[model samples]
Target: MAAAVEDFAPREIVSSRGARITVRAVRPEDEDGFHAAFLRLSSESRYTRFMSVVRDLSEATLHHATHPDATREFALVAVAGDQIVAGGRFVAVPETSDCEFAVTVVDDWQGHGLGRALLTALRDAAAVRGYGRMEGYVLSTNLAMRKLGARLGFSDGPMPGDATTRLLVVVLRGDDGRAAGG
Candidate 1:
């Protein structure tokens, strides 16, 4: 029997600001777009999304991230004009009941609503997959993500990383969109 999750087709979504534009989900043929979008992110933006300084990516990470799948590991891609501007993921981790999330929008797209849209898309996807919770870790310095978390109903908490360096973005009850603390 087909898993219920397979029935969900992530529809393409687009968000535009003035002459700028964005679209959701990368195509299998858009590897270069994926690579370029990733490279456009500032180091800090990358750190906030990946939770550390991403020295670089190995081939495996790139392939798995771009391949469209019905499983818990899914991605939402965003584009602006000729630029592949941003992306995020709703990832399934088998060891926990909760799914995890990460988003990266290039510097230019930061202040706009892209992050929130990507996050909302990821959160809704999690709910569809029967996940009642999601958790994320953001560097303490990345205030935008921290604030976005609060707006999206994520509870704030300290991360186990260096005392002043990391903070955890947690949404305790993923279903209700309530503020959940560490």
Candidate 2:
């Protein structure tokens, strides 16, 4: 069974620094807040997240981010008051029990456990959605994300044909918390 948007309810959480934040599903009305969060990211953070130097998000990109397909994709944002402090999402791979995941935290919010919170939620949601595996591409030099992924049970390896990038993967199923043949 597929999870609905409503499955992602707003829940308050405390960051590692003890800052209170609410995690919830992204909404169309959050476009401005989302954009504002993007703007708060430093150039290095933007490049690491997008794999490119993105000064701004295009209209189509914003639309897609704000309006994820409930059946094949899920997204969540961590809000600290009116500001979107971080966000994460997963997109199903066509005809496969695999999904691609991504996460981003504003410069000021990094290292405060927002990435862990968001990624853990995404992993659990993907498993509930019946996906057997979750993975993401992270720049090899981004040691912070690599370390975080390792802590969350995601294994890292070289991306074929792309040495500068690392492929991070985690099995979402199996009694041991890792599916076979993944």
Candidate 3:
């Protein structure tokens, strides 16, 4: 596992359509804004991100989202003005040098490159942590994600026993010029 990283420097990025957004690690004070962003997501947007119909985030899930374990998990948020516009995270897989990633952009921010920015951050962070691989499970109908995954060098295939889901994976190399896990 990687060492605890309490925070990261904030970065400013321009969306494809020229919107300025700041990307930063999630903080405790972001809970309310994060929830508001979720509420603003259309039902279809929510379903695509969650792969299920989630009207609201559970208290436990909300807390966990805002408070990632410093050692094995990293979460980030993209903010425009005072509101959250996107978020992403990667959680280490137990006993393995691999991480599972998830990313979501609010409906209005979709198709504007926020998701790409967050996913890139997660992938780079995991690589820096010496993770061997990063993987994501996306719904089969999510063509945007599939295309993004492909463009980012992630290979995708059907998830075992899940017809509606596809698993995307990319091997990561560490500073030593070798594949991370083995």
The C-alpha TM-scores of every prediction are: 0.77, 0.93, 0.92
Lowest summed-lDDT stretch of 10 residues in model 1?
1-10
Task: Show where candidate 1 strays beyond 4 Å.
Answer: 1-16, 160-182
Clashing pairs in 3: none
Which candidate, 2 or 3, would have the higher TM-score against the true structure? 2
Candidate that scores best on lDDT = 2
lDDT of 3 by residue, 1-182 (tens): 86244646789999999989999999988888889999999999899988989999887888888988988889999999889999999999998888999998998889999989989888878877778889999999999999989988899999888999999999997567586454
lDDT per prediction?
0.68, 0.90, 0.88
Give the winner by lDDT: 1 or 3.
3
Worst 10 residues of 3 by lDDT: 1-10
Count clashes in each candidate, considering only residues at least 3 apart in sequence or on different chains: 0, 0, 0
Q: Using TM-score as the measure, which candidate wins? A: 2
Clashing pairs in 2: none
lDDT of 1 at 136: 78
